[model samples]
Target: MFSGEEQGKVQIYTGCGKGKSTAAFGLAMRAAGCGGRVFIIQFQKARRCGEHESAERLGINLAQCPQGRGSGPCTSPCPLLTAARDILKEGGADLLILDEIMAAMRHGCLSLTEALSLLETRPAKTELVMTGRGAPQELVERADLVTEMKKIKHYYDEGLPARRGIEF
Candidate 1:
């Protein structure tokens, strides 16, 4: 349960760097530690990772809604839209993280209109956190708090692969 002093707000993590999802996961962990129910909806991803394992161990609600069947952008919005609707209907989480939703919107998997509508209809007590690169300006403007993770330097730029538990 969130403290009375804690208020629900829209928070966005964007830009061309790392730590966006990591920061969101950190917040989820903090919320869970505070006895808050946290729900995570991952867009445009299907594979399980460290966060999935952590969420399971912590007993957080987790849902994976990948946009397409394979690599590259999805042509249809079937999976994303359906998952979004279902998530909205379920609606009991104190913190809701929509990871990569901006990328989904940018990739044409989710429409700006639909995204805005979902934002508008979000539960009053739910703290919404969104993460992804190339976030739409409309969403940036709508968000209460936004952080752009500019890439000053990254290990991947050195031809290093994404390491397990660190990058993956």
Candidate 2:
């Protein structure tokens, strides 16, 4: 549980490189180690992965919102946005990670206004993290900490597929 006195900050990890979600998960583990309640909501992702298993094992709350066919920007209500609003209202999490939310916005599953609202309305004690590529300038300007991972070199360039337990 958070001490209630600790101030939380908004952090973002975005770029064309890998390790954005991995870094967020690492922070989640650290926060959990210190006895903070952590929640992670993954947007545009439904496939079960290593992080899902790890989060379950570590007792972190995790949910995935997969975009079905015909779902596009404002085409239908976004499940992830709904879930995020509910969680924010409940204010149970000490750390909330919106994994791949930037990608969600890029893919037209979420909007800039909606994302900004999430930032503006989050609980005072909840640390928020958003990840994925192509973070908009608006988000970057508002985030307390923003790290853009530069992809200098990648194994994928050599024609290697993403490996399980490494890429997932």
Q: Give the candidate number with the greatest lDDT.
A: 2
Query: In order, what lDDT does every prediction score?
Result: 0.81, 0.87
lDDT of 2 by residue, 61-106 (tens): 9988765323456445687788888888898889999998887887
Q: Where in model 1 is the C-alpha error above 4 Å? A: 1-6, 66-77
Q: Give a tens-digit lDDT track for model 1, residues 1-168.
A: 376455689999999888899999999999998888888888878888888999989988888865332345564655656665666667667888988888777666778888888788777677889999888889899999999999989877799987898876
Off by over 4 Å in 2: 68-75
lDDT of 2 at 38: 91
What is the overall TM-score of model 2 with all chains considered together?
0.93
The C-alpha TM-scores of every prediction are 0.88, 0.93
